[model samples]
Target: MEKSNQLFNQEQQIIHRLLLNAPFIPSVGLLTGQVGIALAFYTYYRHTECAVYGDFAGELLDNALESLDKSIDIAFSNGLTGIGWGIEYLILKGFVDGCGVEICENIDQKIMESDPRRISDLSLEQGLEGLIHYVLIHISASIKQNVRLPFDSLYLKDLYTVVKQACQEDIPDSFRSLAEIYMDFIEKQEPIDYPLHLFSFIDIVHLDTDKLTDYPLGIKDGLAGLLLKEITNE
Candidate 1:
């Protein structure tokens, strides 16, 4: 826990530095959210199923560096202007270490600010990184893959429904105003996904932790109760 907190702080500092040096280019930085979602998924998967999550983080950090190289190559091939890859390795580190959602939303905001015509255009070629695309393609993927909302929190049910509806609905100004709704939904939904390993480390919440200690922890018993309660309410 101490180590994770330390790493989290370090990532925050790194992301701050990169944001300071970040360029004001358009459309190119959209991949930041996509990459963040991938990282979040992997993070949860590590805690739940993988024994080598730490090693995986190290390897992924290295891959983020390599991804910068690829981004540069992509930028050079296309006519996109600004930094070789507007998305930086430090930002990627922050995302993997638990800062991705915030960072991605920040980037998505940049996308919206850069192109105001996207809502009317509704064309990808027109550079529509507004709220809806951000929510559905980038943000939702991260929340669903990493946070395990449906698995944990009830408030998350309403939150996801709202965002999912915004993405699926044909609202005017979805790029700007509609996107705001999506952001609000995400903000409310975060608590559901947060404390990534909160329940997993407890016998009452996650029995696996107790199982490791050879204690008779009724992890499933509690989960069954919770599940029953949820079903009954439905």
Candidate 2:
């Protein structure tokens, strides 16, 4: 066996051992939702330019991404629709270390401000899944529009810039007016009645955060955003 193969085998063995004993280990970052640690490993993968290091770091990157993806999949399967609170919990537990009180509070504020449930004072969010199914039939009938409501908490707040840009030309002014009305109805501090345009709402809530901030976290917004983009295209 050559030196490189021997080293590979050794490292692989160590990884297997760590994975088997992961629950007992204190620093298995993915298990604990410490994505910063995962990102650190990813940096090593991307920046490893050493001739001697070769494919080792690349392999590690694959594992890191796969591990993170699996964790996401497992969480999704077990009803992890939104990761906002989880991230905040990380911040509080000092897992998101170094971001102090002010930054954490800002992050917390952003999360609460954007959620439709928060903005609507829990009114709009109630029966959201059932509401989607019920209204899909009628809206599709009256306007012939096939509505794909944004994912849980994927709000217009998340896609604020998208809305603002879409409303810039105001071909009929309805789009812009609709945007304003929705904002006014769902005022963060004091929500009024449920907006007539309910599907315009989202759980992840419409994604104005596309440019405003980083609420949906990474590609956390996922493919549901494709529908949002397509609608904005009109």
Candidate 3:
């Protein structure tokens, strides 16, 4: 448990640094990737039948999911949609199915049981990644399209490269294939849809303030709060 917390803290610091250097658009995408990592850990810890890693994954997953959902809500409130959803779907699919992890066989059906609005929230969280991909495909879209953006072509390229590396390292071996598929989709200019098939496996739990208070600084009120505030301006 101590070691896990240490590792989580280390990862949080790394992410914080990345966010500081990243442009607003890609920073959101990077945050979405972090959300995916949280969801992946949550799914692996909560839904996996095997108890090989014990309860640590579940605890970490719970906190991570809470942060992720909050981030998604912030994105939705800001009027973003579509691509975020697709990115999240791909991320979840890679984690739950493509990674070669054996999650509950009935996961798809379970997702269908969730509120449709929740599905929308997950999708909207991928806004940054989706927007980036959209620009990449349009070719004629100028960086000046969003005059407020501070990113240049080179910066965007670097952001994508970092995202790819982060996903590869964060996702387990079982899900690496799924991550690769997502990359291929981006490379080939293929359209991405919400991966409805893998939705059932994810169980987004609500965390109360009281519960969050028990978490580490990063999970409790650091990363999630900072990112949400930056994106939402409230």
User: What's model 3's overall lDDT?
Assistant: 0.33
RMSD, every candidate, angstroms: 18.0, 18.5, 17.7
* Better model by TM-score: candidate 1 vs candidate 2: 1
Collision count of model 3? 9
lDDT of 1 by residue, 6-112 (tens): 43342233333222322222212223322222233244334346444334434433444344422332211121111112122223334334433443343333333
After TM-score superposition, the amount by which residue 196's alpha carbon in candidate 1 deviates from its true location, in angstroms, is 13
Off by over 4 Å in 1: 1-37, 40-44, 47-49, 65-113, 118-130, 133-234
**Judged by TM-score, which candidate is best?**
1
The numbered model that scores best in lDDT is 3
Report how far residue 29 has shifted in candidate 1, in Å: 9.8
Specify the poorest-scoring 10-residue window by lDDT in model 2.
Answer: 73-82
Candidate 2 vs 3: which has more lDDT: 3
Question: Order the candidates by lDDT, highest first — what do you get?
Answer: 3, 1, 2
Q: Give me the runs in candidate 3 sitting further than 4 Å from their true place.
A: 1-156, 167-170, 173-178, 197-201, 204-234
Mind sharing the TM-score for model 3? Answer: 0.23
